[model samples]
Target: MPESELGGPEEKSYTAPGKVPLDSGWVDVPRLSLSASAGPGAFGGEERPFDNFRFSQRWLREQGLDGSHLSAITVEGDSMEPLLRAGDEVLVDHSPQPFRDGIHVVRLEDTLLVKRVAAQGGGRYSLLSQNLAYPPLEVNAQDIEIVGRVVWKSGRL
Candidate 1:
């Protein structure tokens, strides 16, 4: 048999054909095709996964996260600059829970926005932006839908 088809001294066949080697200690999280706008954009649409991101399971566990609770979405617009720039990809946690103070993906009216959220008590939240040109918006707790809490953000430096 040829070296390309047969096992070689440099290569070990540890996994079946057309399968990823799970022994490598890496897991994949789905990257949704939907984009979450950092400024004003579309609210809701079809959420189809277009790609996958590989991450170490151990590292995710260390961060108190799991693949089930995580989903990746691309960020659009510069309303949340300085912290979350335009075109950044953010990981969001979809665990069912009450909203807390942190960066989050929220839905106000028919628009979806990525903003820093602060609990203002009395069932209200203040949506803020890192850009000073954009003013903070106060919204009633019931008026907004908390899509997910932003856990991590990544983009080109």
Candidate 2:
């Protein structure tokens, strides 16, 4: 396997064909084919897992995250620059819960977006971009669908 396809330095022990190793110490989180745009919205398409990202199971547990509830997706715009740049990969925690003030993946109409969501009182929310070039969008809570909360992000220096 190429370096990108390999996980950590730990050797992979196999149990049976096509089955996850019993004690690999790491888990493969699926990367969805869809992207969450940081600027203009991207089409919110069907869920399709195209790849897997390996992460230490212990580290996930330490962070109070359930690996089974995690998925990865790429960022597709520069609106969230300085914090989340284009091409960055983000881990989404698909836990069902009330929204809080944070970065989250949200669906507005037919488009998917990644933005800083803040409660604006009276069933309203403000989707703020890190880059000031774009104006913040004020929306009603009912018009937006919360895909998941962005628990972690990875990007090149």
Give each model a TM-score.
0.83, 0.86
* lDDT tens per residue, model 1, 1-157: 2233455642644455434455567777788877777776656566788887888889898988887788898888888888888888999888888667999998888777889999999998999988888889999999999999999888999
lDDT of each: 0.81, 0.88
Clashing pairs in 1: none
lDDT of 2 by residue, 1-157 (tens): 3222355344452244433563668888999988899998999776898878888999999988889899999999999999999999999999877678999999999999999999989999999999999999999999999889999999899
The residue pairs in collision within model 2 are none
Q: Estimate the lDDT of model 2.
A: 0.88
Q: In model 1, which runs have C-alpha deviations exceeding 4 angstroms?
A: 1-24
Q: Listing every candidate in turn, what is its Cα RMSD in Å to the true structure after a full C-alpha superposition?
A: 4.7, 6.2
Candidate 2 has what TM-score? Answer: 0.86
